[model samples]
Target: MSHSYHVYILASKRNGTLYIGVTNNLAARIFAHRNLRGSAFTKKYRVTRLVHIEPFNDVRDAIAREKALKKWNRG
Candidate 1:
């Protein structure tokens, strides 16, 4: 069986702070964020809302998308 890779976005609130990440286990990753165990940035800003998710067949694609999203300016 093949696995899925995902690019996800988490936010503090609508139009608030945002975080971009890539993971093979979307559910577990989101769960970690919700419980303040995702990362220092997420914990510091309370970015717990799962705002966006994109799945890819390859890990490289997901990682590339994640990098692109992170480069997108809020402006």
Candidate 2:
């Protein structure tokens, strides 16, 4: 069996605060975020809306994509 990782983007609202993250368990991560247990930033900003998700075969690739997305998000 093979495993896939995900690079996901969450938004507070339409065009609102954005968050970039990587996870092997997308559903669980999103659940945690929505329940205020994933990240402090998400909990504070209410960034629980999933705007985008990308799948990768490797965790490293998922992390790299998350980092790149964050860089783009910053600027």
**lDDT per residue (tens digit) for residues 1-75 in model 2:** 555898999999998999889988999999999999999999999999999989899998888888888778344
Query: Candidate 1: where is the Cα deviation over 4 Å?
Result: 1-3
TM-score of each: 0.93, 0.90
C-alpha root-mean-square deviation, candidate 1: 1.5
Runs in model 2 lying further than 4 Å from the true structure: 1-3, 73-75
Q: Candidate 2 — which pairs collide?
A: none
lDDT of 2 at 31: 99
lDDT of 1: 0.93
Q: Write the per-residue lDDT of candidate 1 for residues 1-75, one digit (tens) a residue.
A: 455988999999989999999999999999999999999999999999998988899999888888988889889
Candidates in order have lDDT scores of 0.93, 0.90
Which residue pairs come into collision in candidate 1? none
